[model samples]
Target: MLLAGEQWAARFEEFQREAWRLETLPQYLMPQESEELQEFRDGTRIDPATVHNEYTDRLRRQATQGRLQGRVHIVTRPLAEYLRFEFAWYYAPHSLAGERIRILDVTDRPNPLDGVQDFWMFDHSEVVLMNYEPDGRQINREVFEGDPAKFIEYQRIAISESVSFEEYVTGFDL
Candidate 1:
């Protein structure tokens, strides 16, 4: 059953709070940027509105495709280097609400190196990343399991194709 109108509002509020609480730590978080975002920043100047449109388009596409099933929770973290400028954006699943229960974000660690207890819900089959890299590329991490090293490799590929910071924040799906 699809949550509509007022019911969705309540559910969304609950999800937001739950998402924030779950994502409050640093270790569970993943890096946002890849070399591609750097290339975009180095190559051109982009406005926040443009970035917003990019994300909106992406999400609209996803919505149309029905990929955004359930109460999908999204958390976007800004990436900065040299503590000077915000370079990239990180997107992760904070929760998934549906009968299948495909994904869930249970922790808020900022960097993945902090050693997190990976929650293998539903037999470790539902971990999917829509935007795995700072470049705005989407991916599902479940396919790359077994080899820990391949996880990072998959991330690298996703980041290489991710969208810009502007797109990530404003244009793309949050």
Candidate 2:
């Protein structure tokens, strides 16, 4: 079924062992981040030391507790402005906060998981499909409980083919 608002928020708190996300978009339109995004577009940069949210706090807690929380974002060269902001402001802090971030730069190589959309695989048991529009507006999350084997495999493939956030960023200009 479709999950949005509180339902989407609940998944993070509910997942026991791991909350793995496969991010296929270069940017995301987050309502709560409208102002920040706009400022980013206007040329203000986010200080990693000051960038934070409840979500990153949760990531810290999970990491301290020996739980896994991470994601793989597929990106191309000449990064999107939002992505520049996200990596500089959002992803950097999240990584420092103990969330594992990987990048799949498919600017040259063929995407191994071309057809896969964004998704969250919880504890390798359930999956939540993250639906988004062309401009990166989130439509809603869809929960899939039947069998998550495919998603689990996708995670494996992503991790194997991707590089750590630090390595990836250092190789780029952002």
Candidate 3:
């Protein structure tokens, strides 16, 4: 089944224990972010420390509730512009709000999870596969009914191979 709107949003809120994501793309073309992306390109940027949004607000709440949220983005160095924007504007603030962001830099090594699709696994049992177009436009989110053991393994591999977002950004020039 495909999830959208409130259904998709509910997955985040309703997860009982933990919510995790595996991000495989370098650029996600969100139409809602078009204006902000243009602003970034135009040399206007917000201080990540001051960023406040619905997502970040949710992250703060989840942290206070003792629920966990995290993601590991697979990337290569000399990052894409969208990635730079994401790191500066989204990941930085989200991490500070208690989301555990990690980076798996495969710049000099073979991708360990090469064929794995992007997905969100809630409570390590429910999996929602994120389908996207080649240019990074979201297609739809599909509910994966299969056993989540594979996804759990993917998460393990991702965490084992990646560094914390703080570690990735420290002294690292964007």
- Candidate No. with top lDDT: 3
Position 3, candidate 2: lDDT: 85
* lDDT comparing candidate 3 with the true structure: 0.94
What are the candidates' C-alpha RMSDs?
14.6, 1.5, 0.9
Which candidate tops TM-score? Answer: 3
TM-score of each: 0.26, 0.93, 0.97
lDDT for model 2: 0.88
What is the lDDT for 170 in model 3? Answer: 94
State the weakest 10-residue window (summed lDDT) of model 2: 43-52
Clashing pairs in 3: none
lDDT of each: 0.30, 0.88, 0.94
Write the number of the candidate with greater TM-score, choosing between 1 and 3. 3
TM-score of model number 1: 0.26
lDDT per residue for candidate 3 within 1-174, as digits (tens), equals 999999999999899889999999989999999988898888886777888989999999999999999999999988999999888878888998899999999999999999999999999989999999989999999999899999999999999999999999999654
Instruction: State which candidate, 2 or 3, has the greater lDDT.
Output: 3
